[model samples]
Target: MTARSGWVKIVGLGPGADSLVTLEAQAVLAEATDVVGYIPYVARVADRPGLTKHASDNRVEIARSQHALSMAAEGKRVAVVSSGDPGVFAMASAVFEALEAGPDAWKDLHIEVIPGITASLAAAARAGAPLGHDFCTINLSDNLKPWSLIEKRLRLAVEADFAMAFYNPRSKSRPEGFARVLDLLRETCEPDRLMIFARAVSAPDETLSVVPLSDATPEMADMRTMVIVGSSLTRRIAGTSHVYTPRFVAE
Candidate 1:
């Protein structure tokens, strides 16, 4: 796509720290005349000097997108920040949705997405290579999706023997959701399935642990946690912190 003059770059700030942001994403943030995002995401880049910031609540996605587009329309280099990879359940979708819903003038604004390490990838690496092979990611949040649909995807991932990474596993009001997901997985997966739980990945209070699928409980997971369920092939090497997915020819 041709880069438009007054463009908006939707940048991912990575999981939790400023050091985790990609070089390209950081450059965009530094050059941006305006930065718009959710309050926490905006705070991630708070140290940057002289950048106009627009912070909004989590529920105001459309308004955030519109503001970015409006700023770009006025010839500002805008960066809409998202925590983690923008293309993965972040602000990229909202930015495009706004473009499609707004005036054609908004279409002329150059839209670019700068990638960053998603929480799933960060958590997986920290907990060991639980996603070293083919894997699937699902969000357990039922706010934007139906519970039946989430259930179906969980079953599909289990039956396919894909390592699974779950985001937004549980929240205050949705306390029972992660436990129910575990119950469904237990029905289809072996008791020995390796699972890793990572909380506050890449942050000061980060915690990681590996356990068997049958042993994981809702108490072990929260909204800040990323759950990685290993496939049948996943194994941990003794005396090492690494868990690997084998990729060798069978004898």
Candidate 2:
């Protein structure tokens, strides 16, 4: 497809608040004829004028991707919106899956993925630089994957001594997941390993705190929270709310 022709743009809307969107993402949205995403995610960009909105439930990935592709195939610029960096367990994957299945009509449609700030980055910034060194991110949700598999990754991360960031840490019905993660980490990391909890980062009710590993109880976190567990190299500076890990190795 020519640059002037209609194309599918999978844009990451970032985590919470409109201001968090990148300028390039905003330009894509402003030019698109259609926007598709989860209900809450679509709502974040609802006020944009002259755009057709298609909102779906959190579970309907295939349907959403097909709809966006169909629109793009019909010569309309379409943007598939995903919250918190589309590449990080967001809508971008589904978009490619739908395309890979060869929807037939969308074969020649040009697709572009515009990156945005993920929740982990937003949370890390709010709590200080816990991600300064090599780190790993894992989602604690067991809806799609087995808890055993999640536990295995946690163990690997801990043993590798990489600072860790956890997404979907806790929810109403799954309160034990985060605690279980902590228990697993305790086997490899000290109880005093630095931990940072950031809730609703960049939103109106944003909250951030830095504490030790043993102190990060389930009550201190929720689904909106992103937990950053530091490695042995992480430390706190005087009179600052951030915790940082050294990126350079000592000679």
Candidate 3:
């Protein structure tokens, strides 16, 4: 795409750290005429002379994506922003969903995905590789999907012994879902199974706690937290906060 071409760049800002913003994503933001995303995510982009910010509330992904695509079609260089990697439970999928259902001309537009660090990876790094072995990532919020599906996946992940990472584990409106998750784990996993709660990772106020499955509570997590549950092989270094799953699983 040329400098003046109308385009939409879906960019990931990484998890709460300016330093973690990828250089390519930063460059795209610098050239974007309009930046659109959820309220807090859009606020991450600093004010500039020729840039406009469009911030919307949560659960409006499709509408926000359509607005971005429409702006791009109107010759605006739009950046659709997300907190973590755009493809990881973020805005990239929403953009594609809009593109598929909208006008055919939108499919011809120059759309690019600019990836950044996802929260699961950021949290795993802070806790010393709780995701080192086979792993699965799940968005625990049932806003888009049913809680039954989440429960099914949780059970299968436990049965398969995959290290699991959870996003949006608990929120104000529907706090009970995560409690149900804990109950399911109690039925499926051992009491001493390792669980890591990494909150606000890479930010100044970040806190990480490594606990056992028996000790984990629903209240320990919120929208900003990334929770990781280790596989059967995952372990903590004695007397240290570091946790890791062995890469090699014995037959």
How many clashes in each structure?
0, 0, 0
> Per-candidate TM vs. native?
0.93, 0.92, 0.97
Candidate 1 overall Cα lDDT vs. reference? 0.87
Predicted structure 3: lDDT: 0.94
- Clash list (residue pairs), candidate 3: none
Model 2 sits at a Cα RMSD from the real structure of 2.2
Off by over 4 Å in 3: 1-4
lDDT of 2 by residue, 1-251 (tens): 44338788999998897888999999999998889999988888756677888889987997899888887887889999998899998888898899989657677888999999999999888777889999999989897799999999988888888998988899888989888887887777888899888898888999988888877777888988888889888999878665899888676
Query: Candidate 1 on 183-212: residue-level lDDT in tens?
Result: 998888888888898999988999998888
lDDT of 3 at 179: 95
C-alpha-based local distance difference test score of model 2: 0.87
Q: lDDT of all predictions, in order shown?
A: 0.87, 0.87, 0.94
Quote model 3's TM-score: 0.97
Candidate 2, run of 10 with poorest lDDT: 1-10
By TM-score, the candidates rank as 3, 1, 2
Error of 2 at 60 (Å): 1.6
* Best candidate according to lDDT: 3
